[model samples]
Target: MTEIRVRDLRTADPEDTAAYAAVRRAAVPALLATAASVAYSCEHAHPDARYRALVAEADGEVVGTAQVGIAQDSPEPGQGFLNIYVHPRRCGLGAGSLLARTAEEYLAHEGATALYSWVLDTPRNRAFAARRGYRASRTAHFLRLDLARGGLPPLADPPPGVELRSAADFRDDPRPLFALDAETAADEPGDVTAEFTDYAHWLTETWRHPLLDHELTTVAVVDGEPAAFTLAHTDGASRYASGMTGTARAHRGRGLAKLAKNASLHRARAAGFAEAFTGNDSENGPMVAINQWFGYETYDTEVRHVRTIA
Candidate 1:
């Protein structure tokens, strides 16, 4: 076996990272990937993000990569994440182990006390994480919808006092969406709780993300007030992704979330997106049920694994 070396990604040769991302997309079809996304991530990473992308090479060829970073926006300190991906054809060359070790050292040096990673729910993958001092935490499922089939529910006219609009309408003032995001994110299932109190950061990170398709994103309003929304993202291919969907606390159980998502899906299909993808925590029954109603099927499962470094 050839010796494998892990090193930080250099911006000089973009083709190298693009190839790395290609390997990831092939290994994990549930994820939305593109060369632009890879480059944007490296370019727009927050200063406090402490981001470090590592690529593993063996026999002079890149075979594996890992994205390691601190959860800088989390309210809790010392929380970090390290997700590793190895090309399916290169798994047995010790690339996975090398990437894991390198990521851990980087996180530890950055004062991270605990690290979380997602391992596919396959037998071999689960066993690998268990042997490395990591324990299972939570499970999430990736779902896919066939937009080309055109079986989506008919878009219903907004109820008498309700209106529908695109997220792009709030270009001048996105605080309303930011507020909704902060509330809904607090309820999401995760090891590290995110506090979306920084509106400026949200504008720069979420609203301005390269893949975000504000035109297709739907926002529901009642009595001229924002009630629910569905954020959409696309790779400019035939694929689309539901970035986030949420209803305000005051509008729960009113079917506003479903309404917004349906509108977004309808627009996506009309725009020629053949496939749509979304993910949800296994414990989030409401969202899971909503996705099922849209004909999305669970195509993959990932188990969150956590390890304490200190």
Candidate 2:
């Protein structure tokens, strides 16, 4: 077997982006990723985010990839993340381990006190993480909906005080939607806490992202206020992903999130998207139920793993 070497990805190389996307798609087919999305992320990463992409090469071929970066927006400092994926056919070639080692060393050198990663729940994957000193933390499920075959709930009329609209409606001014996202994100179930305080950053990283489809995204408003929304991201092919669906704290019991998501799903299907994907923490019962209501089924599961630097 040829020796496997891990190195920083040449973000400017199209071949590198294509290879990274290939490994990721082969390793985790349920998630949405493309060469364009990969390149755009690298180009527009936040300055404080300290993001870096790495690839493992063997016999002149890229067999594995990892995304490493700090949770710069988190109120807590020294927290970092590393998600590594190796093409299934290339597993057992030491590419994954080499990539992990290289990523962790760099993050630690950047002053990270703890590192977190998402590992598939399969026995081999879990054991691989455990052997690397990472303990299991939380589990999340990747759900898939067959937009062409599965049934989506019929869109119902909004309540007397509520109305449904597309995200494009807020293009002129998205501050209200930003405010709603910030409030809902604070309550999301996760190991790391993130504070979305910079609207300019959000505008650059999210609103202007290449994959975001504002016309397909749906927002639920109550009395002229953005109460809930479902953000949609697409690959311009037949793949669609629900980036996030959230309801403001004050709008909890109104079922606005479901209303917005249902509208978004219908719009995506109508737009020729054949597959829909979304994820939810195992502990988030409400969101899980909502997805189930939309005919989404669990396609795969991954557990969050954590390791503390001594």
Candidate 3:
């Protein structure tokens, strides 16, 4: 067997992104990833984020990839992440271990005191993480809805003084959407708390992302103010993903998030998307219930794993 070696991503080569995206899509089909998103992340990563993309090669073939970065925006210091994906057919060839070790060494040198990763909730995957000194933590569920066959709840009329709009409506200026996103993200259930304080960064990293579908993203407006929204992302084909669905603190009880998501899903299906995917932390009952209402079923679950860098 050829020795597997890991190296930093070569973003200048188009095949680099394609290979990395393929490995991720095959290892975890529930998440939506594209070559453009992969390249953008590598090229536009925040300076403080200290991002690095690593690929594992064996016998001249790319067999795995890992995204390593410091959580610079986290309230806590010295936090980092390493998400490694090995091609399904290439596991056990030392690709995963090599990539993980490379990621850990790099992040530690970047001042990271702890490392976090998401591993599929399966015996083999869990064992793999355990062997690398990681312990299990919180769990999240990946839900999927077959848009072509799922019985979607019909879209309902917004209440008086409320209106529905697409994200495209904010193309002129997305500061308002950015503000709402920051607020909601701060309150989201997660092990790593993120702070979205830079508008320019958000515009470049998220608003202009290739996978983001402005026409399919739905927003709920109350009296002309943005209240809740569901951001949609697509593969520009038959797959759709709910990038995020959130309601402003002031609009929590109004079910605006649900309304926005429903509208977005409707638009996606009508536009020919056949599959819809979304994920939620197991502790988030409200979002889980809402997804269930939309006929989304739990397709897979992943457990968060943490390791301390001593």
Candidate 4:
């Protein structure tokens, strides 16, 4: 008899991790996820977060997956998150429901008070979350640009004392870039209110990420100091994604983030990437405007939902 069962995503088994990535990609094609990145995330996640990936297996095949964890860097305590997805073809097989209940039980037992998850903007997906007591919070848009023919803006020379650099340039000393990322990320809009204060954590979870394309990531150097950057994540294929685009608080009005993104996109195109993808919070007018200026079209949207678990 075939039955659905939820279990840990075994990082040691390459097949298991690959299946997890497969289901997630099938459910959300806009996302750039790889087996390496999935395993790396589970192996290097911050201990405080209690992070674990769960997969729903039916008939010995993975049909659904979930990312369960607490907000390790959030200022508030007992904040947890669960992101679940089932293979588009395998929906209605009860995998999604089983994953949700199992994930909630884990988070509730871990002292989670506020639980959050992302549900795709579809009637069925919304109804699933609502049945579990989650209310909509915010919406985020995933935008895509045709790198080969989006009419990408031509590269411009940086102003005097401002130069564009690649993330690879900072390999010898990434503390400067880390400092810049921490400053910019803290100011970004979010419900968790997380702080990126731990340098070691950043290096582990961000810098060493499998998808991070150092050569494609552009950094804006102001008088030899890192101030803005556009991080790039590539699937080692044709797909390229903007991991983050941010500028330090001191360099907000200088348009350094836009400058870095332009450089990154140009380089990615040159390297033969066919498509570029990025996501922005619906409320982030400035970022949305920048993405729009890049000729990126809203391809998909996901709504965040939150429920009081305690």
Candidate 5:
């Protein structure tokens, strides 16, 4: 018989936390993972977020982990998210089951009426979620680009009075970027709508995130106004991730998003990053096309699952 226990993460044990992140990166390549990111998430999560980092241990060895929390920023009350990951080599030890049960119980206690999760589209993964009563909602694709080998389109000069800049340049005043993000995010396809009205929250959760690389993040400015941007995140190693790429409604059709992303990718490859990753909703045709144009090939797919607790 195997015994499993769930417990919170301890920052003091950096190696242990890194092992958890390693498993996640291997299992979900689209997700940007690093020990620093894990620690920052736990420390900087909002006071009202009710976040919990549960680790599953079997026979005194860590085998799985889960992140459970209330969607504090959502306008809809009682909405929550839980993402669980178990080591591939350690499956069948009941670690995943223990982690999922603990996470669901925590969300329920926090008054969560609906829970959302992402599971790989593989048969085993899908079956696991189905067995737990989670119904499929939508699907997204993970894409990768061989920046070190793929032929990126030639960098076109910005139009008259337009220029390319880095997010670092706006350290003194990121409000312009915030306004652009708010406008673009409103048009993004998703089951849950997001209202980017809180600038302070965005600053804390996004701009200040440990993995965010402001210097490599590319932004397109037209007439000295931010019109589009491609945010970059890195693990300070060989992996780089495209966190979000969006253009203001007014800036669409001008190729501003492509320009920003191309500039960012060139910079990343020049900086020694070997692997680049990004994801897009299956319904987001424009973005999917943009990524495909950049030589990104579909590497994996995940289905969004939802369960109503109420």
Candidate 6:
């Protein structure tokens, strides 16, 4: 077996992005990753987050990758994340461990007292994390829909006093959508709490992301205010993914989230996307049911794992 060496992503290198995205897409089938999207992430990363993407190479081939960063938006300090992925065919070649060690060292040096990782819910993956002193905390499911054939629900008619619109409609002023997104995100189930208080930061990191399709992201409006929304991401190919689906607190139980998601799914199918994917916290029952109603099936699951740097 060739020795695996880990290093930071080469700056402005398209080849590096391509190699990194390839590993990610192969390891996680439900992810919507493209070289362009990878480059955009590196280019626009916030300084506060201390984002660093590392690739593990073996005989000049990228065999694994890791994304390490601080949760800058979290109200708490010292929160960091490190999600690592190795080529499915190249597991056990030491790439994963090398990448993990490198990421852990960086995060700890950067003042992170704890590290969180998403491990695929498999016997091998769970064992690996356990050996590293990482304990499971929460579970998330990845769902996939065959847009070319999945029996997607018909676009529903908006209920009384509600209007369906796309995120593109608010390109001039997205603050309202930001507010809705922040509120919903704050309520999401997660180990690290994120507060999306920075509007300019949100626009730079999310609204303008390379994979985000403003035209396909459906937003439900009530009395000129955003009630619910479902964001869409595309790989510039026949693949699409739902970035997020959220409904304001006051609008929960009204199925506004489902309404927005349905509209987005229909539009995505019509746009020639062959497949669609999404993820939900295993604890989020309502969203899980909504996705199931739209013909989505759980293709995979990942367990959130945490380890302390004492």
RMSD, one per candidate, in order: 1.3, 0.9, 0.9, 0.9, 1.2, 0.9
C-alpha lDDT values of all predictions: 0.88, 0.92, 0.91, 0.92, 0.88, 0.93
Q: How close to the true structure is residue 292 of candidate 1, measured as C-alpha lDDT?
A: 91
Candidate 3 accuracy as TM-score: 0.98
Best by lDDT: 6
Each prediction's TM-score versus the true structure: 0.96, 0.98, 0.98, 0.98, 0.97, 0.98
Off-target runs (Cα >4 Å) in candidate 3 are: none
Task: Give lDDT tens digits, candidate 6, residues 83-164.
Answer: 9999999998899999999999999999998899999999999999999999999999999999997687777789999999
Candidate 1 local distance difference test against the native: 0.88
lDDT of 3: 0.91
Which tens-of-lDDT digit does each residue in 127-237 have in candidate 1? 989989999999999999999984898889888887899998988888888988888888887888998877777887889888899999899998877899999999888
Q: How would you encode candidate 3's per-residue C-alpha lDDT over 188-288 as one tens digit per residue?
A: 99889989988999998889988999999988998888999999999887999988889999989888999999989988889999999999999988898
Model 1 worst lDDT run, 10 consecutive residues:
9-18
lDDT of 2 by residue, 1-310 (tens): 5889988888788888888988898999987778888998988888887999999999989999999999998999999999999999989999999989999999999889999999999999999999999999999999999999889989899999999988899999988988988898889999999899999989888888888999998999999999999999998899999999999888898899999999888988998999999999999999998998888999999999999996
Which residues of candidate 4, in runs, are more than 4 Å off? Answer: none
lDDT by residue (tens digit), candidate 4, 148-255:
877898888998899999999999889998988888778878788868889998999999899999999999999889989999999999999999999988888888
Q: Which stretches of candidate 2 lie over 4 Å from their true place?
A: none
TM-score of model number 5: 0.97
Ranking by lDDT: 6, 4, 2, 3, 5, 1
Error of 4 at 154 (Å): 1.1
TM-score of 1: 0.96
Residue 83 in candidate 2, Cα distance off native in Å: 0.4
Q: Which pairs of residues clash in candidate 4, taking residues 3 or more apart in a chain or in different chains?
A: none
- Could you tell which candidate, 4 or 6, scores higher by lDDT? 6
Off by over 4 Å in 6: none
